[model samples]
Target chain A: MILTVTLNTALDVTYRVDRLRPHGSNRVRAKAERAGGKGVNVARVLRALGREAVVTGFAGGTAGAALRRELAEAGLPERLLPIAGETRRTVAVVDESAGDTTLLLEPGPTVPAEDWERMLHHLGRLLPGAAAVVLSGSLPPGVPEDAYGRLVRLAHDHGVPAVVDADGAALRAALAAGPDLVKPNADELAAATGLADPAAAAAALLDGGAAAVVASLGPDGLIASTPQGSWRARPPRPLAGNPTGAGDAAVAALTLGLVDATPWPQRLAEAVALSAAAVRAPLAGDFDPDVHRRLRPLVDVRPLHPPRSA
Target chain B: MILTVTLNTALDVTYRVDRLRPHGSNRVRAKAERAGGKGVNVARVLRALGREAVVTGFAGGTAGAALRRELAEAGLPERLLPIAGETRRTVAVVDESAGDTTLLLEPGPTVPAEDWERMLHHLGRLLPGAAAVVLSGSLPPGVPEDAYGRLVRLAHDHGVPAVVDADGAALRAALAAGPDLVKPNADELAAATGLADPAAAAAALLDGGAAAVVASLGPDGLIASTPQGSWRARPPRPLAGNPTGAGDAAVAALTLGLVDATPWPQRLAEAVALSAAAVRAPLAGDFDPDVHRRLRPLVDVRPLHPPRSA
Candidate 1:
């Protein structure tokens, strides 16, 4: 079974308002909520595609309980470590008419040192049986940026490959531990390497110690680079839909490839197909099974441009 | 024991932000949560003032459970009726530098017919021995406009006084049921009576079948009218604060008066003093004990104009 970790999970709430007027009260016409964190989203898509994935992370107070209940209802298994404070809620006021989403994110509760250790202990036990472990999302307060690096070494110690999907310092720290794979969007790759071109940024990540790197270019599709080979794949035609969880979908496909020992080119093609399918899905990380199967064969794959002459 | 009813209870969440910009994403710096609804606010204040109060009304799902936990932490007994949907949250974005507050109110979940019946059954059990029943705030969907009226009649049938604090049709409907008291802010009173003068509106409410009426005039204090007498009690000085829960504080004082059978003049004075004291307190419905005591003598009470010539 695939293992996913979301250290700073959130109860994602979306409220539909006619319009959002700052400093003025607006009435919501409809509301939707779901358990959220990068790893959680990845696990959700994995399950939707008929994969077994368990989510483990920090959850506390009422919001945490709500997250667990929502996950259970969605048929996702979660092993959350309890903390003292309530989980955070990220509110998105989506204006139906304008199609604009205004986001308000709370930093979430601070995890005590004891809770952090407890989570590490739990993860240590779960990593042994895991086919691959995916660590994603932000680090909650009181957790050091280097926590992911430590977890990466633990996964390796248990003979399990690890996939890291995070941003900023945590991503930087995790890269030094030689993760099996790292997935970063165009902007996140740019920030990590200060490189404007995706090719240059992907190379930087590969050199930083990842066994390989798959950089998501959104509508531009997926690009994968390894020491032995490189490949590129994109959808037939651009899809129109919310692209919120496309990266998570790609990550899920990548993990599936590792578990099944699929070749790099096939893995890249599958990741591209799943990510495109996710963009067309209304709810995040969910793709229509029939559509997914139909689109899987359409993913066009080719050799990427040779790495920059450095 | 006092029974407080909040038809549309909410989980009040306050998020502190350094600067709030419209159409831009913001990260909340700090967070706080409390059980909120006008009647819940009154009950919390009553408990803080050394009174025993039981909060009864709708609460459901995880957010509702959080609301219950907050009430318990405040040391108040809660008899919340569970429903199918979760309670809503009212977001208050506080800007400390400017001392400005931006409110984002969620309409809360709708109450099913069964939920309403369950609440009525609960009230039926509590009304007989209750000193007073306080019905407050906006009614959730699936509840009739005459819900407050029905509750008022129920209280009267059991020989218990009812104090209602609401706006528009809810308050008007309660008046037709001859509730022991109705508390309307200046705007609601004007809209209810079509009279610009608050005192005249108070008289109109009493004439409309209400046993008594209290007009909350913001920092100007309160105007109270009953069959026995009419009076005005003005706070000595106008103070500025987030006036979110001042009216709830006034309702708490009014409930206290009915229980003690205090005369209208004294009741008006207490209401004004409590409201003023609330402005100085940090949280909603909370009054600084010292300020509450000090403001008692400053409340200026004057006899209302005798029944106007027809």
Candidate 2:
């Protein structure tokens, strides 16, 4: 089973209304809720692709219990640690008439030191049995800035590869631990490296200590920079839909590729295909199976040469 | 204890943000969640006024569980019946910069026939020991349109008076069962009786079988039409903060007056004062006790005579 960790997990709630009236009451036509955070979403994608995945993180109060219940209902496995503070919720209010969405994101709870230490111990045991462990998302307040970095070292101790999907402080901190892989979206790549060009940003991450880096460029597809070689993969055509969880879909495919020892080209192709499929689907962590199947072979992969002794 | 029934309860969630950008993601600075519905709000007001108030209603799923937990924390006793469908949530996004709020109200779960039947049995067992039962709010789908009516009849069976805080079909239907009292805001009163005038609307509700009708007219205070006589109560001056639960505050005061057999003028004065005090508070179920006390006796109450056989 692939183990995933989400330190700041959330209850993702969607409210569909006929129209959103600013400063006025809106009657929601429909609503939905689910467990979410980068790692949890990655686990959900892995499960959808027929891979066994288990999630571990901090959950507390009513929202935390509700998150656990939803994960159980969705058939996603979790062994979340209980905390004193309530888990946060992210509300997406969709305006049907305007065809736009407004989001309200709550700052998640602060994890106590004891809870963080307990999590490392929990993951230390689970990592040995898992093929790969994913460390993702932002650190809740009260946790060390290098929270993911510590998890990476723990994975290495268990001889398990760590797939780090985070940005800013968490990403930079984890890079120092020499993670097996790191996935960042366009904005995250730029933020982490302070570079305008994607390739430059990707190269800087490698210099900083990551073994490999995969940057998701949304509709432009993904770029993989590794010691073996660098490659850019693009979907045959742009797909129109929600792009919220597209990166997680790519991460799931890439993690599977690591486990199966697939070639970088083939892995990048799979990542691009699955990501496009996720975009075409409405909710995050869900993809159109048929789209993924049909688009896999058509993905365009090409090698990128390093700068000639600049 | 005064028993307040909220047929369609909600988890009232409030999110505070520095500014609201419609169609864009906003990070919430703070958030809070509590048990709320018209009846729940009324019960909270009663409790704050040093009255022993207990709440009863259908609570199901995570939101319902959260509601019950909050009620316990508030020290309000409850005997809620569980149902299959999840209770709804109401999100109030407060924009601090704009100084306004945007509400997203979920259409609560449809209470199945079996669950509602079980609720009736639950309430019947508790009604006999209650001084009065307050049936408030809209009926969840799958419950009868005359849900409040059934509860009013049940209260009568126990020799207990019934107070209704409802509008539209629920209010109109309950009046036919001869509830001891009914409270409606200006819009609800207009909708229930098709009368533009507050006094006329209150009279219509009384004629429909309610023993008394109290209409909350916002800053204008309240108007009461009872079998004894008619009177209009006005606050000394307008007070403003948040008017969301002003009517529920009024209902809380009126119900207490009924239990104590207070005179109409005094009851109207109390209702007007409490309602205005609620308007001076931020949340729906809270009021400034100082404001209430200062405004109570200062409320101007005057009797109104019916048109002479016109």
Candidate 3:
């Protein structure tokens, strides 16, 4: 089973309104609530793809209770550490008329030092039996920048592969521990490598210590680099809809590929096809089975030059 | 016992922040939640002043649960009618530096017609036992403008004194029922009567059908007009603090006075003194007992000619 970590969990609230007026009272026509965090999104996508995924993180207070209840209702396995403060809430105002969305995001509750240490200690206990672990999303306050790096080293010590999905300092810090795979979108890769080209950025990350680096190009699909081979895969065309969690879908496919020992080319092709299918799903982290089946045949995988070892 | 009705109930969330930047994310340093509606605030103050206040109206969903839990925690009795939708939440960002507040209020959930009838029916059962019934706050959707009017008539039908603490059509409609008293702040009174002068506005409302009118003039104290007499009662002075719920405190004092048979001159003095004390109590209701006692002696209550009989 895949284990995922999300330090900053939120109760996501979406309100459907006819129009949004600043500083004006609104009567929300419809409202929905869901548990949210990057790793939680990844776990949800894995579940949608028929894979077993367990979520672990710090959840607290009433909002935390609501989150756990929602996870139970959604049938997701979770082992959340209770903290002292309430979990945060993020609000999204969806104005369907003009097709523009305005988001009001809350930066969640601050995690205490003891809570952060407890989460790491919890990860130490769970890593041994897990085949692969995912360390994702922003680190809440009190968790150091090298947190993901520490988790990566712990996973390596336990003989478990770790997939790191983050950006900025946390992503840069995780590379020295040699994660099995690192997924950064084109812009994030550019920021990490100080290179403008996506292909060159992926090469720099692989050289830095990642066993394989998959550069997600969003609408252009994905470019994968590994020790044995490198490949570029593209969907027939860009899928239409909200692309919020398509990358999480790709992470699900990558995790499955590693566990099943699928060839690099086939894994890259599957990841692209699944991601395209995910965009068309109404809610994030879900793929329409029909769309997935229809798009799988259109993914084109081609060999690319392997990066030169230093 | 004093009975208060809150048609549009809200979960009032207070967040402490250094400042408020529109369209930007905010991390609340301090957080608190409470059930809020004008009538609810009145009931809370009454409880603090050692009075039994029974609160009623609509409440629903998880937010409603939170509201009930908070009210119970505060040691106040509640008889909220559970509706299908959750109550609205109003966010107050308090910037301690500037001592200024920005309010983001949501239009409360619309009550269904059947639910409205149930609430009215609940009032019917409770009105007979109340010494005074206080109808306060805005009318939620699906509740008619004449709702307060109908409720006022209900109280009078049972020979109980009724006070209407609302604005616009709801206040206008309630006046037709000739409630014992109507309290409108300077702004509400101005809007309702189209008169900028507080004394003139109070007289206009009294002439319109209300047996009496009490115009709350913020730090200037209160002015009341009855067919028997008219008087102005001003407090000693103002204190340093948030003045958000001062008006509600005034209402609480007035209601308590009427029920306890405190003479009108003393009632006017008590309302002003209690409202001043509320400024010192911050978010919690009830004036500082010592300060209230001290200021009560200084309240200047002088009689004048009543509005010339129409």
Candidate 4:
């Protein structure tokens, strides 16, 4: 079973309104809610792909309880540590007419040092049996800056491959721990390495100690780099829908490939296909199975020249 | 003890932001939440005034549980009956720079007929020891249109006074049931009676068998009509602040006066002072005690002419 860690778990709420007018009352036409965080989303996608996945995170207060209940109802396994502060909620106000979404994200609760320590201790016990450990999402306040790095080291100590999906400093620090894989989207890639070129940024993460780097290039598809080789993968055509969970679907594919020891080209192709399918799904943490099946054989993965020196 | 009924309770959530732009993401600067409904606000204000107030209504689902927990934390007495549908949440997005609020009111979960009957039976047991019953707020879907009228009859059957703070058909129906008092703001008064004149519209309710009619005239204060006499009351000057709960505060005072059998002029004066103080308070269901104390002695209460037609 693969283990996924979301340091800052959230109760994701979506409100659908006929039209969203700023500074005016909006009567929501419908609402939907689910448990969400990057790793949680990855774990859900993994389960959908017929893989065993367990989610672990800090959950507390009423919102946390609600999140846990929803996860259980969805049949997603979770081992959440209790905390004093309430969990944060992320609200997406969807404009039905325009089909646009406006988001309001609350900064997660401040976790105490003791709580972080306890989580680390708990994670140590679970790392040994995990096929791979996926560390994802933003670090909540009060957590050390090198949290992802520490988790990567712990996973490596247990002979478990660690996959880090993060941005900025967290991504930078995790790279230093030599995580087996690091997935950064285009915006996050530039933000972390100050490189305008996705291939160059992915190569930089590899040189910084990550065994492999996968960079999501939005509608342009994905670029990946490793010490042995490099490749670029994209769907036959861009699929348009909610892109919120596409990256998580890619991470799920990458982790499954790591467990199977698949070839780099095949892994990149599968990641692109799954991501395209996820984009077509209405909500995050879910992918259209039919779309995935149809797109899997059509994804184009080809070798790329190593980036020229920075 | 006073019993306040909030047929449609809510978890009132406030999000403070720097500015509000339509169809744009908003980063909330701060957030606050509390249990709220017209009668719930009345019960809270009554408790602040050192009166015994017990709240009862339908509560269910995760939101309802959170609302109950919050009420318990605040030490407000409640005995809400369980229902299948979750309680609604009302979000107020307050733009700090503009000092304006945009409201998003969720249509509450539909109530089944059996749930309404169960609540009525539960309320019957609590009414015997209650000094008065206060029916307030909108009736959730599936409840009968004459819900408040039925409650007023129930209170009279037990020889207890009943106050109805509602609007439109519910107010009209309750007035016909001979509730001891009915409070309607200017807009609600006009909607219920089809008359723009507050005094004349209030007298129409009296003619419909209500013992008294109190009309909240916003910044202009309150005008009250009773079979014995008529009176007008206003604060020394309009209190400028959030007016969200001002009308509920007035209802609290009116209910309190009914329990004490206070004179009409004194009741009107107290209602005006409390309502103004409530306006100065930042949150609903709370009043500025200092403002209430200062305004109470200065409130202007005087005789008024009876309506010409009704």
Best-fitting candidate, measured by lDDT?
Answer: 2
Give the C-alpha lDDT of model 3.
Answer: 0.84
lDDT of each: 0.88, 0.92, 0.84, 0.91
**Which RMSD does model 3 reach against the true structure?**
4.7
lDDT of 2 by residue, A40-104 (tens): 88999999999999998899987899899999999999989899998999999999999889999
The segments of candidate 2 whose C-alpha lies over 4 angstroms from its true place after superposition are A306-310, B306-310
Q: Is the docking of candidate 2 incorrect, acceptable, medium or high quality?
A: high
Q: How displaced is residue B96 in candidate 2, in Å?
A: 1.3
Which residue pairs in model 2 clash with each other?
none
Distance from true location, Cα of B15 in model 1, Å: 1.7
- Tens digit per residue, CA lDDT, model 1, A1-310: 9999999999988888887766767787888888998899899998987889999999988788888989999999998888888899988888777777777899978888888888889998999889999999889999988988999998999999999998899999999999999999888999999999887788789999998899999998987877856778888877878787888999999999988989878888888888888888766657656656877888898887654444
Kindly report which residue pairs in candidate 3 clash with one another. Answer: none
Model 1 TM-score?
0.91
Relative to the real complex, the DockQ score for model 4 comes to 0.64
TM-score of chain B of each: 0.97, 0.97, 0.96, 0.97
Ranking by lDDT: 2, 4, 1, 3
**Top-DockQ structure, candidate number:** 2
Q: How well does candidate 3 score on lDDT at residue B280?
A: 79
Q: Which stretches in model 4 have alpha-carbon errors above 4 Å?
A: A306-310, B306-310
Worst 10 residues of 1 chain B by lDDT: B301-310
Fnat of every candidate, listed in order: 0.70, 0.98, 0.12, 0.62
Best by TM-score: 2
Residues B150-176, candidate 4, lDDT per residue (tens digit)?
999988989989999999888877887
lDDT of 2: 0.92
